[model samples]
Target: MTAALNIYDPSAKPTAGPRSLAGLTRPQMLEAMKSAGVEDRKAKMRAEQVWRWVHHHGVTDFEAMTNIAKDQRGSLAKAFTLARPEIVERLVSVDGTRKYLIRLAPGVECETVYIPDVGKSGALCVSSQVGCTLNCTFCHTGTQKLVRNLTAQEIAAQVIIARDDLEEWPTSAENRKITNIVFMGMGEPLYNLDAVSDSIDIMSDGDGMAIGRRRMTVSTSGVVPKIQELGTRTRAMLAISLHATNDDLRDVLVPLNKKYPIAELMDAIRAYPGLNNSNRVTFEYVMLKGVNDSPAEARALVQLLKGVPSKINLIPFNPWPGSPYECSDWETIETFAEIVNRAGYASPIRTPRGRDIFAACGQLKSESERLRASARKG
Candidate 1:
């Protein structure tokens, strides 16, 4: 008979504070177990059980892991935490969208949005970094400086927190309110691709969160180098934040275009893995009045995506405080869509959800920086 494992060291003080295992990958969890003094032989098995409890059940307490031996559970508890980050604010829009302002560290914060009726069910848009490096001129998050790339754990925690609030626990395929996820919240996901890749592994694990890879879409403002690598690693759908049809206009709107111009971006889109009629890349074009919304520009867009498997998502520019751009008139948007639609591509006008509460697309700036600015003014 095998001896019961007791890996606890009452006299051993931790080198660092206990970190929550809520969103760590299985390999990460196993490493955490070993650090907790779990025998290497026992760490793997223990990690799988705890991973299920943390992800599938969304449990916040080791005591709730009923299958584990009581003393062993106490040992795990001493080694790690299951607590969630502090939610600074939870704002809900009249249109049934929910926005969460999560404080990751003392000064590091990010915003996540839950929008209903997106895709087969609904979608949660999560950030991969504290702020953005791409100063996409029309976006609120661009106004904030890049603090740091979020770790894999931090990125996954956004989904974990959203799931907790929606009361959508136990990881059932049925009754899932958030059927899809978009990396369109605050950060440029490709800039933090390693963490994003690890997070997808955790979120898609069959015994845990179980969100399918196809249902996760990562939007980028033309980070050309990482495009193919993102597809190969995560296998998530790709969405391009291509606001303007021409090079000069795109350079003004998305400044990153200066770095990775439209031609390079288009080439990358063409070579994205698994791109077919069924698995299409989405081009997100924000329609700005009198800027990139002309019918001629629409024709140019058709030419841009000429031979690619793609659908264009026409986002009516969501306005923020002192934003320079105005949304294109409805008729203008329709005419532009008509031109693209005529070219045998689907051009869906994205509904501006959570606009009333400033939770809509291109409007996700966390309160941390805003508060700091106010303090400077004070």
Candidate 2:
């Protein structure tokens, strides 16, 4: 077994002292204010004021909250912080995709990617863990062993850091650059359920980040038991990393399928709360050449997803160094998508982006590890 590198030391202190206000929800913020000596009647008001400053205005320092009284601001600053993860490296792809290597405590790093689309819109892919536990053969992150789950603060910090980079402040409904958030980066989000949900709650809070739940997507690699819970708790968009149609093939493609097969996964999806035509589940199918991208597999996929409000995203396998799989040819992917489209599913072949900077789908792995490996080799 490959040993996990750059794992977070749980015993180490996360930060110097003060609690982070970045990921706290409204109620949590109010409670925090109360604990910090704010009166019961004034706690809610003070929390709201701090929330607007930290999230709405993207102010890092409590002193920047100009409306708050000087003494109150000093007390709040002494009690809590709004510090985000330090950006160790920021790489901008030639095609306008920006990948940030964010450092969460010492020796803990994860990557967040921002893919720019047409107009003032883009998607931010955030990581939920320092390293991934899932060893999906085709995934770059899977090469690293399980490290640790990110805290709610760390998870929400990705968005805050990205917003800082984009200069997307004042939390606008119009002219938004980071319009969508995908829990599809470094680690399996469902594995870190509570933190991920809390971070989502903080991000989707109307008076703060204001990102609608509909625009946020959580992708899981068939964690069946958590699927229903995720839908009920978060009510955000759902996507499955379902590269294979049959259990026999899926077990090999996604190791997690060995525990919860396709049938069980489908059953979980069917029972997902608020699942309907408008709120459709997405099935992410990475087209691996000569593996799970045949026309027959597409037919099986359509049959498997029958009666489930869904769309199939056919992704061309993004290559990484030492990866064993090859992307399916364009003609092969087209043929496979045609079968699904004919069966009434919207199977769009996802155009690969940020390939030059290794920021495309399935390409996020921390640069710290890569550099370490390079150093050892040298």
Q: Which candidate leads in lDDT?
A: 1
Off by over 4 Å in 1: 1-16
Question: Model 1: per-residue lDDT, tens digit, 182-287?
Answer: 9998888888787888889989888998899999999999889889888999899999999888889899999989888999988988889889998899999999
Let me know the TM-score candidate 1 reaches against the reference structure: 0.95
TM-score of each: 0.95, 0.93
Best by TM-score: 1
Cα-based RMSD of candidate 1 = 7.0
Error of 1 at 60 (Å): 0.8
lDDT of 2 by residue, 153-238 (tens): 67788999999999888787468899899999999888888778888989998888998998999999988888888899999999
Q: Candidates' lDDT values, in order?
A: 0.88, 0.87
Candidate 2, residue 307: Cα displacement in angstroms equals: 1.3
